[model samples]
Target: MVQRQQVVMFEIKKASEAEIAERGDLADKVADALARAGFAVHRDVNDASGALGAMAWADPADDSGGGVFVRWLIDPAFSRAAVQSVQQGDVESAAFKHFSTVTEQMYAALLAILTSAGFQSEDADDDMSPYTIRVKG
Candidate 1:
C-alpha cells in the first residue's frame, strides 16, 4: 500500500479592512517576530506581482534529510498569511516520522508566537485539513 504524503498549512486571517490595508506592514512585523524567535527569515524579492512577501526557515538541528521545509507567504489580495510545511524527501522514508515530529513542534511554536503577539487563532476542525491552524488578527 502507498501512504499519501501530507502537507500542513496554516492561514493567518486579517479581521478587518484596516488590517487588510496594512498587510505589508503587518507581514514585516510577523517576519521580525519570527526572526527574533530564532527562525531564519528572508524577505521575498519577487513580490512585485502583488504578493506581500514570502519567508522560509528550517530546523537548525536537522541539517540532514530529516528536516521539514516550512514557508510563509502573505497574500496581497486576501491579506492573509499562509504557513506551509512539507517533508524534504520521499514520503515513505523512515525519516518521515522525524519530519512529522519536527513539523508539529514548529507549528506549535509558530502559533504561540502569533498568539502572544496579540492575534486570535484556533486549531483546525477535524473535518478540516489535518494539522491546520487558522489564525485571525
Candidate 2:
C-alpha cells in the first residue's frame, strides 16, 4: 500500500479577554509541543475572519489519518483505497486507533500546557461546536 500523509488540526478558542490578549503566547506553547512530537507545526490567526479563531496543523506521522480521507470519500481518488479497506474490515479500525492515539497524546500535552500557562481551556466535546477544539481529553 502506498502511504499517504495525514495532518491533524485543532483550534484554540479564547474563553476570556485574558486569553484573547495572550494569543501569541498560546500559539507558541502549542507549536512547541507539536514540534517536540516531530511534527512541522503552523499557526494561523483569525482564520475565516475570526470565525474560526486560531488554527494549527501538525505534519503527518506514520500511518495517521487525516481529513483527506473523509473529505474525499466520494471522490474516485479514494475509491480504490476505500474499497480495499472495506474488504479487509480491520484497516479502518486500525487507522482510527492510530488517529485516536496521537490525538489523545496531543490533547493531554496541550491541556497541560494551557493550564500551566493559566488559560482556561474548553471541553465541549463537539468538533464543530463553538467551544474550543481539543484532541481528546
Candidate 3:
C-alpha cells in the first residue's frame, strides 16, 4: 500500500580508474546483483575536479510480495521516523541519532550495497565519522 520513500546516503571506496577497467563490467554487475538479492539499488560514479565518490540507493519503498514481514515493518518505521521530516515538505525533525538501531542497521545496508558493487571497504565509523552521506541528485 506504500507509494514513495527516501533513499539513505552512501559513499564510495577503493574505486580507481585502473580498478574500474580491471572490473570493467562492475557497474552493471553491482546493479544487477543488488536487484537479485532483493535490494533495488542504484549506483553512481562521479568526480569534480579532484574530488570523487561512488554512491547508490536502494528502493526503500519496495513491496515485492515476499511477505517476510521484517522489510515491510522496517520500511515505514524508517521513513516515518527518519526520512519524512527531511524531504522539504513541512515538518522539521531533530538531529539524527548516529548510534541508534536505525543508523546501525543502515550501516549494514550500506555495506551490502557497496560490496555488491565490487568496492572493498573496511567502512568504519567512530564519533568522528559522518552519520549520513546525503547522495546528491
- Measured by TM-score, the strongest candidate is 1
Quick one: how many clashes does candidate 2 have?
A: 0
lDDT of each: 0.47, 0.41, 0.40
* Candidate 3 runs further than 4 Å off: 1-18, 45-54, 57-100, 110-121, 124-137
lDDT of 1 by residue, 83-111 (tens): 22123345554445455555567667777
1-137 in candidate 2: lDDT tens per residue? Answer: 99998998875432445433354455566556545655544454323232211244322222222110000002232334444565788555654455445445655655555455454554435455322333311
Error of 3 at 72 (Å): 17
Candidate 1 lDDT at 97 equals: 47
TM-score on alpha carbons, each prediction: 0.43, 0.36, 0.33
- Clashes (N, CA, C under 3 Å) per candidate: 0, 0, 0
Better of 2 and 3 by TM-score: 2
Ranking by TM-score: 1, 2, 3
Q: In model 1, what are the clashing residue pairs, if there are any?
A: none
Candidate 1 lowest-lDDT run of ten? 59-68
Ranked candidates, highest lDDT first = 1, 2, 3
Candidate 1 accuracy as lDDT: 0.47
TM-score of model 1 (CA atoms): 0.43
Per-model C-alpha RMSD: 15.5, 15.4, 16.5
